[model samples]
Target: MRDRLRATLALVVVGLLAAACSTGGGDKGFTGTRLETPYQAADIALTDTSGLPFSLVEDTDKPLTLVFFGYTHCPDFCPLVLNNIAAGINMLDDDESAKVDVVLVTTDPTRDDEKAMRAYLDGYNKSFIGLTGDLDTVIEVGEPLHVYVNDGKKLPSGGYDLGGHSTFTLGLDDSAEAVALWNQETSAKEFAADIRTLLTDD
Candidate 1:
């Protein structure tokens, strides 16, 4: 079992390397960059804050699905990314807002309980969905998305420390195909514009 797990993790690392070097980001006016090879959305199972079984394919209800991976305890990037997303979503009219769904998957499942996840997300947008599960399960879902998650540091106290993660948000079209990616610098208005293009472009 240990060998298998290590092998799987090795493959994930290789995939991340390849993805990082690929020449994607080709769009003209997108706030988020475009990937030359838009990854096919991976359908992994996890539990939502509401205790319901969730999978990417089943949970994505709109034409555009935005997926982010990070922990609630993250003192910087995570909240900033979500806040940007919420702002982007708010920029849309009712019709446009209804066309998108934003999801956050926790990297620090050890400390991020349902209550914490719910409260953190509610501060940004009530409609945003938060997902958490066992460590292995979260890694399985995150790996294909090129989200690197660490178990975190150990504190002098009994509690575990917060970990780090890749701070990019992925955008997927209705076909469940990855279409765009946004880095920490992306603005809400730019994100909204890219989303609109993704929903309409061929």
Candidate 2:
């Protein structure tokens, strides 16, 4: 099931990218893929790293929000994406950085309780917000964004592998609508560039 969802997502991304390219996306001046129809940010309440109720649209004060869905145990993509975003934000001026918010909603809530989520996110950027709650709630929140989340294959060590999930970082505007999508392969430089463009447009 997870594999099928991932394949479907890949195809969708390819189609979006192709459409953007054919339309001369250069006019947008964004390094990330601009969504033809933006997704309204989910307003559901979830527990933040601080163990307090948080609403993505209400709690975030920034004009631009970058949200990602991944688990702490993800062996590769999660850390890499977080690190790149952190680095990208660091490239901006103090005022510019302050205008953006980074959010990570864990896909593996079974192990990513409030405390664990906070600790893992601090390793990349202390300012980044980490959120975790019931797995069902997580899936519900991700639905509008086309983010796939599911338990992974069990392992022999009495543990399990990282869960399957989407790797795109969604860029949401102050209106709580996702305006762009950054893939895992996007470099820190590209992130910085797109962030600047988004901020300027906002």
Winning candidate number (lDDT): 2
Residue-wise lDDT of candidate 1 within 106-199, one digit each (tens)?
8777778788899999999999999988877877876666665543343342222223325678887777766677776678888888888877
What tens-digit string does per-residue lDDT give for candidate 2 at 1-202?
8666865666566556535633245646566777777878788888998889887778876899999988788788789899999999999999999999999998777888899988999998899999888877877887776675643344343223333336779998888888888877788989999899889973
TM-score of model 2 (CA atoms)? 0.84
The Cα error of candidate 2 at residue 72, in Å, is 0.5
Model 1, TM vs. native: 0.80
- Total clashes in model 2, counting residue pairs 3 or more apart in sequence or in different chains: 0
Superposed by TM-score, candidate 1 places the C-alpha of residue 184 at a distance from the truth, in angstroms, of 1.0
Error of 2 at 100 (Å): 0.7
With a 3 Å backbone cut-off (N, CA, C), the pairs that clash in candidate 2 are none
